[model samples]
Target: MAYLKERHLFPGGNTSKGFYSFYKYILSQEDGNRILCMKGSPGSGKSYFMKKIGAHFAAKGYTIEYHHCSSDNNSLDAVVIKELKLAILDGTAPHMVDPIHPGAVDEVLNMGEALDMDALFLNKKEIMEVQKKISKTFERAYRYFAAAKDIHDDWSSLNAESISTDKISTVTESLKEEIFHTQKSGYGADRHLFATAFTPNGIVTFAEDLVFGFENKFILNGGPGFGKTEIFKKIGSTAQRKGYFVEYMHDPLIPERIEHLLIPELSTCVLTTNEISQTSFTGKVYNIEDFCKADVIAANKEEVAYCSKIFYDLIEKGLSLITDAHTIHDELETFYISAMNFDVANDIFDKVVKKFEKFE
Candidate 1:
């Protein structure tokens, strides 16, 4: 009914590695929960199927999270209804639910069965050709991303070498006093996923929406590779020790590095800024530049400019290649869509929705 929805990525393509996955983190808050894993072809209505289910719950005032496909943001990798401990996902490539399909916790829903096999068989050769093209297109995209990553590393190293560990300690300690204030006896849960992704549309982040609901929101500003993650990690570690759950929204470029942190237990969130966010800070602002050597950054102005230009150019090329991949994907979808029997597919979707009604 209301505009109450959140978007995230389960599997994201990036510069560091070709395909990165955080699908396991979807609905990870609770195990043994009901999971409806959809098995289908490209245009088998998997995304459309999930959309209807998500809308149904949202109309009832249920806040849902759509785990969008990084390659094609319009499609979903998963839909999480945390309160119901239920999720319906496109259990397909890149984010395949596991080698066993549904695994032990998930219940399989096969939309592939609704396909008109005779029709698909007629286009078998065309389908294979398009699928092969899609694979090659993505490979080209990853090559460009790989090239960009090298330059980015060189750029980051320029600032990283001059970081002040002592200053980092000082600010983080202040954060502990200012944010945590007290400690708990036990440890807290830590969940990980990407808050931002490098898609065909370029770098996309839902940081504002992800953190908007928090009453206490903070933005961390700093130079590249300085101490953004270090600060967030410090805050997250401190939150965990103080019995608070932390959601570490990692960087798409460097999956290991956190770009943002969420501490819902404290109704607080602290995220890095710049191209990643546009939200006005409602809480404290920690500038990582304050923790790094100013003169070192000053000296590397030329290097920063040089590396930045090359890195961004290479990244743009990669985005174009990814766009090619998306185009190829559209062609592949057409084959399946042509063979799809929506009347039968909708019947299957209706039955699946019925099974999930108890949760509503």
Candidate 2:
């Protein structure tokens, strides 16, 4: 069966203060998969090359996971062919990845070798200027995020009394028991994904895909700062201990918050969301919002609304800054594109694909 799924490794905007990467988890030892890390500058055709590889395997009935770039949703960061136990990813700045088991299970593909370095060096001054502009715009974006985080923290603190940690724990314990029945020996690997991403359509999520292979699913409905992450952590940890590979999908706005957990061994999933309606869920609906104290919500209603407005407004500003950074990045790409030899790059990529055909 050919299956395709897309997920983000990092979120766009100020959600993460520094570079956030899931490369370690993707290239973990447990999977024993070969990683072909591509090294190249922007517009060197890394993304295009990976996509061609993905399409080739997908046509041969392999399940493919497309890891998308957070900054430019149109581009891909990596592609995985799970059936072949293989992956090829972009190994560059902000998400640079190196071979853990070089000459064994990992190797590097230098796409930059196909570039005319002499041509690129001629435009060094212009390229450096654009790079500096990109850095400045990204800094502005993070500042907006820092400010938004402050407002969100205040809102959480104000509503702390309304949320019951004990209740959250109890619910989690019950879920653990219900799912696992009896704990198993050995630990399974953990994988990370971003359910929500900053795309051209604004913030978007692939939440529905989380329940694809599961017979039983739980859709959690609640607001932020309500111990949702704690609940997900407990369940995911429990499943890992019970020897089930778990895919943890995190929230884009709040990096610490896990929005979904897929335990493939048990064919089950637990997803948290406020935007998706319960009626649309294929499985059970768990409305954790009911646990909130109505009286506390009533008393803090005005402050909550004001804080929320401020947080969202700041987030919008941060996103706009990111958009500006991408604009500068696009201009920077022109120099690299001019230096790259597409004909040579395409030939190299085809050879890479032919090597994978041995697996068939």
Candidate 3:
């Protein structure tokens, strides 16, 4: 059976305000593989091109990973074929990717070339103004995230004293030994399933998709600063050392914190979140809340609730700004769409299909 997995490269979070790209990991030539980098502006059919390629491979019973855009979940950022060690990604702004191996292992497919340059230049002034507005909106969103992070940090600090180091060590060691019986040999790949994208609706997580084929699943439930990430990292590190391909899903807001780990070779998945309980998965849950100082949490219940509200409110404000940015972005895309030559783009797409046919 084909094993398909989905994930996000960049999350909709504070880190996105800077350069936080996982494309280098995806385009790594460690295995001497090839990558098709699609270079184009918005509405140039880049996402559609990736979707078509993914569908073509899925039809042939190959496992494909669809990397969705953090800003617009409906759009795709990349598609991966694990068996072939190949990937096709959107190489544009915010996450611009350049070929490390150039024509050898990496090549560029300039979809923007099919656009009418003269027509685009005709609306250059309006396009520039819209671009500026888009940037400003994103800046405002990041400012909101920064404020939210401050409140979150304060809340986490309040509970930091309640975390038991002894319990963390015990849990980490036990989980490590159980997950990785013996260190095999080589290292493995690490990946993220979400980006810094928080929409007005709320946060998005593809945890279920990542664990779809796993037979053994463990959900670790605990409060903030409870060492859940430490446990996940311990197991993931051991798994990587033991020669298992590991996908480490990081918390969008906290990149250093691991949210989930998937070792496909063993069909094992370990997630650290209480939200998994809401899912259909009937996995064994190991509650780490036992190690937390319940008395302290109970004492500061009101303070905790207040801080949580502040964090959520700031995040909501950020999401509102992002929504506005997307609105302007949509208008920006209209100009590009009008300037593009779909007929030529279709011909190029057909050629790309023929190239993939050779893979069969």
Q: Which residue runs of candidate 1 sit more than 4 Å off their true CA positions?
A: 1-11, 29-32, 99-104, 183-185, 274-282
**What would the per-residue lDDT of candidate 3 be over residues 21-137, giving only the tens digit for each residue?**
556655467763678888999889899888888887777767677777766767888887666677888888887787888977888999988899999999999999999998899
lDDT, candidates in the order shown: 0.76, 0.74, 0.73
In TM-score terms, candidate 1 sits at 0.92
lDDT by residue (tens digit), candidate 2, 172-244: 8778877886656789778887766654335656666645556778777766667778889988988888887
Per-candidate clashes, comma-separated: 1, 0, 9
Model 3, CA-based lDDT: 0.73
Worst 10 residues of 2 by lDDT: 1-10
On TM-score, the candidate that comes out on top is: 1
Task: Report the lDDT tens digits of candidate 1 across residue range 268-312.
Answer: 778777433233555788778777888988999899899988977
The weakest ten consecutive residues by lDDT in model 3 span: 10-19
